[model samples]
Target: MSFRTALVLLTLLCALIWWQATRPVGAPATPSRSGITTSAASSRCPMPPRTERGAMPLQTDVPAGMSLQAIGETNLRPLAGFSIEARVLGREDYRIGHEADISPIDLALGWGRMTEDAVISQLDIRQSSRWYRYSWKDTPPIPVEEIVRSSANMHMIPADDAVAAALRRIERGQRVRVDGWLVEANTNNGWRWRSSLTREDSGGGACELVYVCSITRE
Candidate 1:
C-alpha cells in the first residue's frame, strides 16, 4: 500500500476511536424477559410511598418473589442484592474494572418530576461512580437539594451478559427499571463498599452498589 493511503487509514481509525469514546449514548435496549425469573403467581408488592421531603418520587417495590443474592465480595463485606426503578439522569461506564469486575456503570438516577424532561432540561448533570454534580443557567425550577436527594449515583454490577448489554445501551435522560440487590463488598486489604438504603443522604458511602439481574428502559 502507498504511504499516503496508509496515513489516511490511520487518521480515519484515530477519528473513529475518538468518536466512539466521546459520542453520547442512546437509551437502553428494549426489555427482554428471556433470562428474568420472577414469581407470577404471587401478588405484586406495593411501591414505597413518596418521602415528605418533596423530592422526586423514587418508588422501590419488592415484588412477591424478589430476593437478594450474592454476586461478588470485597475485603470486609459481601455484595448483597435488591430491585430499583428510576429515571436515568446520566451514566458512566468503566472500561477498566476500577473496583474489579464487580461493578461497571455509574448510573445517575432520578424519578417523579425529576424524570420530566421539562424539569431536567433546565439543569446540567454529570455522573461518575458514586458521585454526581449539577448546574443550571437560571434558578432551578425545584430546589437543588431536592434534586440531589431525589437522584442517586448507583454503582451497577450486571449479573449476566444480557443485563450488562442492556446497561451498556442506557443513555442519559432515560427512565429505567432495574431488578437486583443492594450489595456490600469488603476486601481483606480494608477496602469496602456498601449500598445506601436511603436516598435523602449524600456524599461518601451514599451510593447504591447494585447487582442487576434485569434492566430495561421505559
Candidate 2:
C-alpha cells in the first residue's frame, strides 16, 4: 500500500489501543495469557483491614447419593464433605501430569495462628510439585506439629469454568472459604490418587484432593 494509507492505519491502531488502555471498569475485560477472560475490572476486591481469624476447616461425612464424578477422563469418588475458611498462604498452577489434567491448581492455605501475620512473617512458605513447605530463620515461630495441623496444600479441581477463573485470581494472603468435597481420583488404567483423611499428619500423603464447588473470599 501507499505510505499515506499505511500512516492512516497506524494512527487508527494507536488511537484504538489508547482508548482500551484508559477505558473504565465497565469496559470488557481482556483475556488472560491462558485465554480466560476475567471480570476483575468490573469486580471490586477490597483488602480487609485485618486478617480474618477463623476456625479450622470443617469436614463432614459424604452426603447421600454422592458418587463417582467424571473429570478429564478420571472418575472422582467423594471420600468426605470438606470445607475450609483460611488465609491463602501461597498458590501454584500446574500444566503437566495426570494431576494437572484434572486439578490444575494448589493452594497453600493456613488457618488459626498460621493466619496471623505475626506468625506468617516469621516463616518462609513455598509450594511446588503439588506440595507445600515452610521454614524459619533461627527459632521456629510455632511448633512444627501445630503448623502441620493448621496448614495444608490442597489440590483444587474447579467444578466449572467460573470457579476455574476465580481460582486463577486468588492472591496470597486472601482469606477464603473453599467449599467442596474431599475426593479420591481413579482411572480405568489403574491410576489412583486419594485424599488424606486427617490433618493431624504430615509429610507425603497428607495433602487433600478437593473438588471445589465454590470459594467465598472474606
Candidate 3:
C-alpha cells in the first residue's frame, strides 16, 4: 500500500484496539434510581422472612377488671359457662415483724380465688386472725410476715355464720366458687389483677366477699 494509505490503515487498527481494550468486561450496568450499586440495591430492597403467633392457651391469672364470665371462660378454663363460686375460705392473721409487739398490724386473709385482686381483697378483709395457722418450720413462724401480706382493698361487712365459716374453709384449702363483679386497681407495685364476686342467688343482702382466682391449663 502507498505510505498515505498504510498510515490510514494503521490509524484505523489503533482505534479498534483502543476501543476493545477500554470496553467493560461484563454488563455495562446502569445506575439505580438512588444511584447506589447493584450490591447496595439488593441490601436496600432485602426480602423479609415469614413469622407467626401460636394459638393462645387458657390462662388462670384473671386480668384486672375482667368480668366473672370472662375469667371463668378464658383465664380459668374448665369453667366454661359455669358460675364462679367464691367462698370465704377462712381468716388468717400474720405478724409483720420479728417481735410480736413490734410487728405491724395483723393481716387477716381469705383466699378462694386465684387472681392478684381477689387474693389481695381476701387477705385485706375476709381473712381474720383465727384463720391463720403456722406451718411447721424451724421455729414458730412470724405472723403478718411479708410473704403472707396481700395488697387488696376489701370491705369488712358483717357476714352470717355460714358465710364466716365458709371463709375459714378457704383457709383450710377448700375451694369455693363465688359470683361477683370485676374491679381494677393499680398500686405502687406492678399491676394487681383479680376478680371479685359477692354471694348472689340468695336474698338481697350484704354478702360482699372477695376471692383470688387464677387459671392453669394442662
The CA lDDT of each predicted structure is: 0.65, 0.80, 0.29
Lowest lDDT block of 10, candidate 2: 41-50
Q: Which regions in candidate 1 have their CA more than 4 angstroms from the true location?
A: 1-81
RMSD of each: 13.5, 9.7, 28.0
lDDT (10s digit) by residue, model 1, range 99-197: 746787899988767777888889888775448878888699789788867777888876555566777778887666775556667666676677887
Give the per-residue lDDT of model 3 (tens digit) for 1-66: 799999999999999999999974432223344453221111111111211122111113343433
- List ranges where model 2 is wrong by over 4 Å: 1-53
State the RMSD for candidate 2: 9.7
Please give the RMSD of candidate 1 to the true structure.
13.5
Which is superior by TM-score, 2 or 3? 2
What is the Cα-based lDDT of residue 68 in candidate 3? 27
Model 3 TM-score relative to the real fold: 0.19
Pairing residues by index, what is the TM-score of model 2? Answer: 0.75
Residue 68 miss distance in model 3 (angstroms)? 14
Expressed as tens digits, the lDDT of each residue in 1-218 for candidate 2 is 99999999999999999999987543233554556444331122111122123656787886677574487679888888777889999999999999898999999998889999999999999998998999999988999889999999999987766667778888899878777778899999999999998889888999999877666566
